[model samples]
Target: MDLNISNIIIASLGLVGAMIGGFLSYKASKSATQDSIKAQSEIYNKTRELENRRIFENKRTSAKIIYIDFLNAIDEGLNIVKEQKRQHVGRAPNLLPMNTAYSSIIVSLSEELNPEELSVINRLYGIMEKVRHDILNLDYILGTYDHIEFDYRILLVEVFGNNYKEMIETNLEYITRDLIVEKIDREYKKVFEKLRVLGELNTYGN
Candidate 1:
């Protein structure tokens, strides 16, 4: 009888030890799984942050290049208009090339921009195009007469003179001394402001 009781106690202790060991092992496995999940999450977050930073940097660089190109086109256009004004007898090839360059930049900017920025840029471009047309028409009329007529002078004053004055008073700067250059400068300012707004929105979105 004594031997049987001792055997039973020993078996009971063995079963209890096994249960405790199993509980400890399960706890350790759960902890290891949680640690792995946390490590993966940290890695994913870091990768995402780096990608976002790269995208932002690329966008900023592109914007700067476009802005510089726009400024250069405006400067070239103004120089052409000034030369035409001074010579009074010839059509300026400079204007055509500058216009082409400006158009290309506008197209590129439109592709790069979001819808809101594109809309503003388009409106500004349309306004500048009308101004350019007016200048070209006036140039033709002046060339035909070899002198400015009253009617053509009136058209020029209305389209270029008054508009230029308004732009200057509003703090816009032109690339040339000629007032007609204000047309391009004002339009460039509008584009710049719209781009700035778009950039802010992009940053906030990110």
Candidate 2:
């Protein structure tokens, strides 16, 4: 009877030890799974941060160049317009090939540029186009292109002389550089200042 009891006790002890080992193993497996999930979450966050940083760097580099060029073009174009207005003549070609500078800024950064800023640029372009049209049409109607230099002049004094110039000048006086250019400059400066953001535009029209 003693031997039999001893054997039973040993079997019970073995079963209990097996149960304990299983519980510890279950706990270890759960902990490992939790760690794995945590590791993946951290990796995902780091990858996203790197991606965002790269995007910002791209905007700071490429977009910055475009904005500066556009600004310079505006400044130079305005100066030329002011000069021509002083002489009442269009001596230079198409006011500095405005189409190129205008298209470059608008097209390349089409998606990135701000809606309000885009509106202002478009408005300025429209005004400038109207002024060009009137001057060029006058050149064609007067046959001044053939006789005199096909120049953009507030008055075709070369063709009509001073006395006849008043009639043509009246139509353009409202849209002259003096009358409208300052407003264009102001609006443009406001739009550009926003794009001049160093950190994120946070730059370029966010």
Candidate 3:
């Protein structure tokens, strides 16, 4: 009877030990599964962020290209205006052509810009609009006189002179002309410096 009791107790204890071991194994598996899920979630979030940054950078670069093109058109128009003014004693009616070209360029640039870059582009657009308004006022002044008289010439010179000054001062850092190209290059370097940070983040996981 004593031996049978001892055998039963030993059997019961072994069964209990097996149950506890099985429970611990299950708990460990659950914990590992949760950790794996959390790690995967983190990776997915990082990948999504990197993709967004890449898209933003590409859009910004595209907008910059269009802006640079528009600037080139503006410079060309300015050169034409200056040359025409120098050659003709009176207000030549050629301002309309130049103004139209500048307007078209601005329209093109505005269409290409993404919303993220719109603020800076809009500011530049506003400046162009002001320049256009000034040109229109100059046109009215010139139209009042039948021929390019001394007074009319002086008004033309003053208005256009101021316009040129404003253009030069505002765009000195962006103009690609050889004389100012070095300054523009420096400005471009700064732009790239900002871009590089974005680029590194984008390429990090890859």
* Regions of model 3 farther than 4 Å from truth: 84-206
Question: Candidate 1: TM-score?
Answer: 0.52
lDDT of 2 by residue, 1-206 (tens): 99999999999999999999999999999999999999999999999999988866765654455455443344334334334343544443243234534555454445666777677656555544544554456544344432112222321222123332342434433543333222334555465555466324422234
How does residue 194 of candidate 1 score in lDDT?
Answer: 58
> Can you tell me which runs of candidate 1 are displaced by over 4 Å?
84-116, 119-188, 196-206
Clashes of each: 0, 2, 0
In model 3, the Cα lDDT at residue 27 comes to 93
lDDT of 2 at 70: 45
Clashing pairs in 3: none
TM-score of 3: 0.41
Give residue 185's error in model 2 in angstroms.
3.5
Model 3: per-residue Cα lDDT over 126-188, one tens digit each: 444444444556655436423323322333233234343544454434544433222233433
Q: Per-residue lDDT for 1-206 in model 1, tens only?
A: 99999999999899999999999999999999999999999999999999988866655554554444344434434334333443653544233222434444455555566666556555444544544554466545335422222222332333344364444343224334233333534544455655545355331112
**Candidate lDDT (C-alpha), each:** 0.49, 0.49, 0.46
**Cα RMSD for candidates in order:** 9.0, 10.3, 11.2
